[model samples]
Target chain A: MAGEVESIEKFLDEYMPSAELKEVKRLLYGKEIRLLEFPAEAEELAKEKDFELKGYGCDAARESSRLPKIVRIAGVQNKIVLPTSAPVAEQRDAIWAKISEIIRCAAICGVNILCLQEAWTMPFAFCTREKKPWAEFAESAERGPTTKFLQQLAQQYNMVIVSPILERDEDHGDILANTAVIISNTGDVMGKTCKNHIPRVGDFNESTYYMEGNTGHRVFQTQFGKIAVNICYGRHHPQNWMMYGVNGAEIVFNPSATVGALSEPLWPIEARNAAIANSYFVCGINRVGTETFPNEFTSGDGKPAHKDFGHFYGSSYVAAPDGSRTPGLSRTRDGIIIAEVDLNLCRQVKDHWGFRMTQRLDLYAEELADVNKPSWKPNIIN
Target chain B: MAGEVESIEKFLDEYMPSAELKEVKRLLYGKEIRLLEFPAEAEELAKEKDFELKGYGCDAARESSRLPKIVRIAGVQNKIVLPTSAPVAEQRDAIWAKISEIIRCAAICGVNILCLQEAWTMPFAFCTREKKPWAEFAESAERGPTTKFLQQLAQQYNMVIVSPILERDEDHGDILANTAVIISNTGDVMGKTCKNHIPRVGDFNESTYYMEGNTGHRVFQTQFGKIAVNICYGRHHPQNWMMYGVNGAEIVFNPSATVGALSEPLWPIEARNAAIANSYFVCGINRVGTETFPNEFTSGDGKPAHKDFGHFYGSSYVAAPDGSRTPGLSRTRDGIIIAEVDLNLCRQVKDHWGFRMTQRLDLYAEELADVNKPSWKPNIIN
Candidate 1:
């Protein structure tokens, strides 16, 4: 028996090259072997085959790790209008019908989550100084028709809905808040996150109409995953996205109603930046089409028909965790953008890149905290 | 005079529609104001021009805020390769001449910073790991001929030079480090940021030849602005770029010697991510052309020529802070890419987007520092 074994070994050694030894080892050991061997004459023949096998193994492994999970999201770019000459009742009915149409279509598309542009049930009223009548549209979050409609739709379609609206706290009386409601598929109110930053410039005379949000940053837990919303103009601020990411949001939405000229360039920059920095997918929805509203006020210089209301140019898009964007559904057409997002991609990217892991956050906190101080101004002028 | 003004306004109001009044305002303030009040209509226009402007007096009394000075910068992608297989002494001479030629040409084209491909002075030696005698081509960082030659060229042309090389740290007993050095225009050793991450898979076997970098994140201060280097495989890590940005780097260079098939895809992804996330300009330099060495190492598994060397497909490019890349400098041509980048663009972006000001550093720190056990394991059996 020993002679027979020796003869077999001699025959293998004579024919096999040292290079093929590792492959032969793998055949004997099943899948456990790290190295292998083969016959000298077989070396040339095995090269192409070995690479092909390795490529196949890698592809299979990547595919298995990347199991696809489909997610549907919907957004409404509130094109609600309030004609200066029209009564509040007439305006409200017109806007509500438009919003209802949006919600119905979103439900039909099988969206699990639907978000509306900032204050979806009303026109952007912060563009002028006229206050009292405009403020009348604001109501209690739970009592508002926008929330009631969205909540009913969530139950009807078994989907989570995000309703952004102007909230008038009856208890607080004077202060209005820009609030968003996170409703469950079962129509239960999950939570709410308010817009933290309010712009005080240009057409955004938000300070005249509403106070800055005081809810602090918050994320909602849902059946799909942890999610958060940064409403409209809040997308301009990176902290809004960062707050959600730190709180464990895997998906964040930036629901906005902005014009093409004023905010188009910012679209590509902000969404991708938020995605790459936080390692989370971002769904950005902008209102499509134009809304015409009658001018109610003149400029301080007594100029008639001072500023025609701006157009809400919609070009909504979704950015993946890898900072790549899917071709948008449309800016003009009200539609949903469906994508297969693997939550695992976030983990894989963060593990490999370690943006969050290696960041020296301590230094940034101390330095950036004082950057806006009056004393921090540099002498150099632009 | 007041009665005349009131009478004219009343007459206009009685005769013109509100839309016509809107057109009058545009005529007064629009770009075509001259056409609205033509000289033929009134030589009285010349008399009105002499009247003192309302805001002009205040503007004259108040000194204008000094504008920030703008400096134009040009980033050059130098696709370079040293003849490594040639006799060592002859190879060193050829490289020195090549370095001088490149610097002179780049300076003539008005490039502010010329970044060469990673380890341009030596061929990549990690293909098979046999440790041939020629592998000693990797030199000490402080005394390397490549570093010395570039330093001389920097002083000669008064240009900032970024040189990446296979560094053997003499102070650390010749410990190898993949390093990139940023030399000031005056030839001062500004600083060096060693590549922190070493890729272990695919065509990248860098860890086999060099250990991970020990230098804490660093940025070099120069006449142009703050600059940093992400050497070769380090570009794969977004945190590496973030570190540079947090340290106040305005321009970052990704010097890479990557091949066509494996790395070309990563090329578009990595640089754009770095630029968008950090809001800083990125210059990506890649080596061009196919390089074949004298010997091939068979796989330990007795497979024929297990490692077929890679072709360095050079698609060098410069990405603006907004993530827009200039048409890539040709991979085929060994030439300089020059673009006048306004340094003021960084400040303009920061002011507009407010990314740094709005970042929530405290929250990110806590999340990243939490080293909880992972929830999943590597899928090895796929």
Candidate 2:
């Protein structure tokens, strides 16, 4: 793995200035600006690197001639097609192997920040009502093997990795949370943001296993950009998305594992609204494929009992600050969506549309303070 | 118009138990149940009524055999297809005549609560940047001619009418606000909810004319159902929608005057998200057709100067608490959409989803109270 990382680095360092890179850059910048081309040996080296450099594109924006900055982001929406009812350890191993391949692919494509779907290490088994099999999947945020693997990749590629996992807080007596751990380019654990809103609808009885996030909306000042993670159900809460923008997040990632029946229509709405309302880029990721449990469950809609929790449609896409979005990745297959975003677009959009400047935070603060009161009123009838 | 209203009442009285009405009812309730029908003279009364009932659909759900209450809500998305540069009075009269016809149409369809688009009596001329012509469109929400006319219609049909108007709040020194006057079935003023969020983008430079609402989120308790209006720009704010639900709004209407390029993508997202997140029915209405102002305006997108504000794309639709949504109205024409929604679904969904019960409101209140503070921190890294 270490050797693979070095080869990937060598290929990237060599391929950074090729004519192919320039064409991709031109397509993004909208004008042809000459970029120096690397030697032919770099192409040969990439071929020999054993790293699949699939789907590469570059987007750059220059606020000024000298202040050019770009943030390349990737969303990995994977399917859990492993053998059904496999042992927990075997399931973990199979998932890890698939994730490693995608991470390598993202690194080869020069992604500065990469994000995985919520609880990426395990099947979404909380819906089964059989708690033990799923609870056994929870791991420490700091010492988890998933984190260790992501850290290695993050350091090797000088990339920031957002890994959402089922966290067992050993220090807090094994209290669980749907946590997103940020791994810095230096292979250090930057921090974690917990899932703020837990859905209890139908088969999404996530509260049966984990509690609502104790950590407030935390924006990580990573090497590439300022980023935040609004894990899964938090997307439905506007305030949850607003706080991240309030804390100055340039990009927010929503890593989710929601089924199609429960959230497909909502899938296109929430994250895109968050991006437009907050004036920031949003990368929406979802787990794909169907997962069947040992026992059947009913959705309370008077439907027949079913062992599967519907499809986890993986139509992951990136929405820009200007409310434009990219085409989603495959909904039934494992895939990676890489979007090249100009972080300056966040500033440009904020300036053009003064949603932040004109939000009237004071009014909302006063109103929100009164919402939970016993005698709260929505408005003055008089 | 009074004759039209009386004719509708006679028709409804006669058709209550007709076989045609039974088929529609059975299609909605998902089971065949006999319902008493109106006399045959009702069909003769409709023939003499001289009105057209546009698009209509029935959707109903009953949790049990006993709890059966249905609310039929209609959203009128009218276009200002009158001469674009007509006199202010002429424009007002023309718009009123068109809306009156739609009201009659809605009444004939047996709509219980009828909501018109934002400022339905006036052309959305804030984009023109010409003050006097647009300013003249403002009227007193309590006693304006539009309200008086709607009151008459409300009384004649026994319908709750939601009329969004550009309000001239004379008591407050002629200060203006985007106000929705809720007229009760008995021809009295129920109350008014002002638009809380005002847009300052491009042609939607509404802040220049009106201040943000001080009325906050007001839910009107009418005979048909408890309802609320979030008005146009407020739709982008999730808290705005949530507050109405908190105040026990079974149905929330978003009366809007937005354009295609600016908000078409968002049109489908916000109201549906509101319905699902708040577990209430959301009816979204927008004015139709394109308006050409006298002068050109720039949206800062580096495009050429344009006189028109693009298409309004009047795709009004309704979303249920169960996340199902009706298709939008016509994008290029004036239209009315009637949706038959079971108010019981709101409660049934809340019971199943438990979003309201499980929401950590205290945590959010504390967090929201700090957002405006200068020393607010998203999270403590240590």
Q: Please report the candidate that would top lDDT against the real structure.
A: 2
Report every candidate's CA lDDT.
0.58, 0.75
Tens digits of per-residue lDDT for model 1, A231-291: 7777765555666776667778887766643555346556656776687877777765555
Tell me, what's the RMSD of every candidate?
20.9, 10.2
Candidate 2 residue B276 C-alpha distance from true site, Å = 1.5
**TM-scores for all predictions:** 0.69, 0.84
User: What is candidate 2's lDDT per residue for A31-90, written digit by digit as tens?
Assistant: 332222323443344345332222333344566654645777888877664754888878
For residue B269, give model 1's deviation from the true position in Å: 6.4
Candidate 1: lDDT of B31?
Answer: 14
- Candidate 2, Cα interface RMSD: 14.3
DockQ of each: 0.04, 0.18
